[model samples]
Target: MKKTSKKNNNFKIPGTELNSSDAERGKKESQSNFVELLPLEVTSKIFSQLDIQSLCRASRTCTSWNHAIRNNDSLWKSHCLTIRAVCQREIDDDVKSGYTWRVILLRNYQKSKVKYEWLSGRYSNIRSPVSLPEKAMCPMDADTWGEILDAELEREVEKLQ
Candidate 1:
């Protein structure tokens, strides 16, 4: 007696054996957006951990991801709060004026960074505009200029003493 090995053909075309409704359902299931699979809180938690640039990139990847990121204010709030460390007055003013956290962030994010650099005296020694670092400088409000001036004055006073 000769023994023969049986081969299993596991590769099957999708919807081959299902009815029309079942095939449609299967297609929907297979094409379901991953962002929609998770609960809102779960997706928010996952997205909140991403850095600002990564979050923006993720939001642009697809409509579902943009919806998830855009609709959740908490993610933008947390990031805006971090920027508040450098731009407290601006952030507070915007918040008081009823600007959403995302809008506040969009308005202040780069300004805060530039303001921090100025406040931190990163540009204190520039002899002229030509000597300044090659970077994008956002327009700062008068109050921010005052703060930077104050920091510079304090440094000068310390030097004089």
Candidate 2:
């Protein structure tokens, strides 16, 4: 007796079964590999999995992704502020509560008041005591950065001593 060819059977795709109601749902589900295609929330979860360097590099990959990461200013504001430690200083109380960063930037960089106002006012919410270097300020190199860290550590150790 000859066996029938399996291809002759009008059969359901073994793993492609759809319990979805609408054709659109079925089509979307079938075309989208649930295993591969993440939902937006899941995509964000995957993004958060990346290290800081990976995240920054990924942002430059394309326009849409870049927009997403860059627009999330609040997420990186703290990091930017902390790394900007050397630029920090306390402003005169008489000037204003949160003008420290601007004041330090202008003073350390010797920027004009007009340019200072232009640059500082661009940030939506800035530091109270000022953080982050001004545009004119030359960024500290790794050696200088290390020295600053060492000085800070020495001060901290001395305080505990």
Minimum summed lDDT over a 10-residue window in model 2 is located at 86-95
**What is the C-alpha local distance difference test score of candidate 1?**
0.84
Runs in model 2 deviating more than 4 A are 1-14, 17-40, 74-161
- TM per model? 0.78, 0.32
What lDDT would each prediction earn against the true structure? 0.84, 0.46
Task: Give, for candidate 1, the lowest lDDT window spanning 10 residues.
Answer: 2-11
Top-lDDT structure, candidate number? 1
> Largest TM-score belongs to which candidate?
1
lDDT of 1 by residue, 13-117 (tens): 855786555555556657887687778988899999999999999999999999899888898999999999999999999999999999999999999888888
Q: What is the C-alpha RMSD of each candidate to the true structure, in Å?
A: 9.0, 15.0
lDDT of 2 at 2: 45
Cα deviation at 40, candidate 2, in Å, is 4.3
